[model samples]
Target: MKRNILAFMAVMLMLCMSAQTSQAQLKRFSIGPYVEAGFPTGDFSTTHNPGFGVGLGADVKLIAGLTAVGSVGFDYFKGKTIDNGNTKIASAKVIPVRLGLRYQLISILYVKVEGGTANFTGDYNNGTGALVAPGLGIRLLGLDVEGKYEAWFKDGTHGFFGLKAGYNF
Candidate 1:
């Protein structure tokens, strides 16, 4: 029920942002710092729970309704206590470099998809894997709000529901 409500709210927000675009000239370029919280699912939950991410990103307008997006992000997931033993206080760290495009459906509302490799290490076996993300974005008053579902297909299938908010300049 919570996911459904969040989805509904996102749709309504896009509608509202689209309505406002008709009244003002929208910005074509933006750069900023972003932070994301991740909820683990599937096999990822076996070892790690919820986590946090930080990144820097940029958007450049290409053509009508199209923009190029790129980001470098870092995420940390703490290990879970298993068999009554604490795995190391050190958290697994993952760095991902992604590039993709955003399509503006209406005014300040857009749909985005990105894919790249995430490199992970620390307190666990080092590994690299592909990351795919599909998401929605709402830009209002120099602030950017995004919600995305991320998947890491690696040693095990890992998934996350992510929420990200940032200030864009």
Candidate 2:
């Protein structure tokens, strides 16, 4: 199982690295940084407050209108007050690494899906989980605006709806 996962990662990495051909009229690659605001949903909201994150991403044009994308990011969430407002859950932090594909649907519109892993650290515990995100975005000039639903699964599932903005170079 581990070997298979490694093999898949290797293939994705190769695809992301192979944009060396010079004949394409479009840009072959882009790199950017983004900031996000996240709102926890379902039971996750009961214990956690809204969060913010920052990420850096890279994209390699695989073909016309298609790109392979990868990113690493950090998110921080403070705990919510509980038990008659006398106690609070510990703040949590997450580091996420992801790889995925983006397909342009129109001149400035795109859709994307990403899967990877998120490592979680809290005041009292730590763990890792599988992460999946599906999103819609628009690119105007060098700026991008996106909205995504992100789910993280370990023993159970937690999710957030997020809005992000970025500038690609």
Instruction: Provide C-alpha RMSD values for all models, in order.
Output: 10.9, 3.8
- Report how far off residue 94 is in candidate 2 (Å): 0.3
Please write out the lDDT profile of model 1 over residues 1-169, one tens digit for every residue.
2343345345534544553475335655566789999988876777787999998777667789898777777888887877568553456688877778999899899899998777776656377888899999897877889999988767776788999988866
Model 2, span 1-169: residue lDDT tens? 3453455557545644564355235667777889999999997888899999998777877788998888778888788899899988887698877889999999999999999987787672378889999999998977989999998887677789999898877
Which structure among the candidates has the greatest lDDT?
A: 2
By summed lDDT, the worst window of 10 consecutive residues in model 2 runs over 15-24
Candidates' lDDT values, in order?
Answer: 0.76, 0.82
TM-score of each: 0.77, 0.84
Q: For candidate 2, give the lDDT of residue 146.
A: 91
What's model 1's lDDT at 82?
A: 70
Which structure among the candidates has the greatest TM-score? 2
Clashing pairs for predicted structure model 2, backbone only: none
Candidate 1, 26: how far from true, in Å?
9.0
**What ranges in model 2 sit over 4 Å off?**
1-26
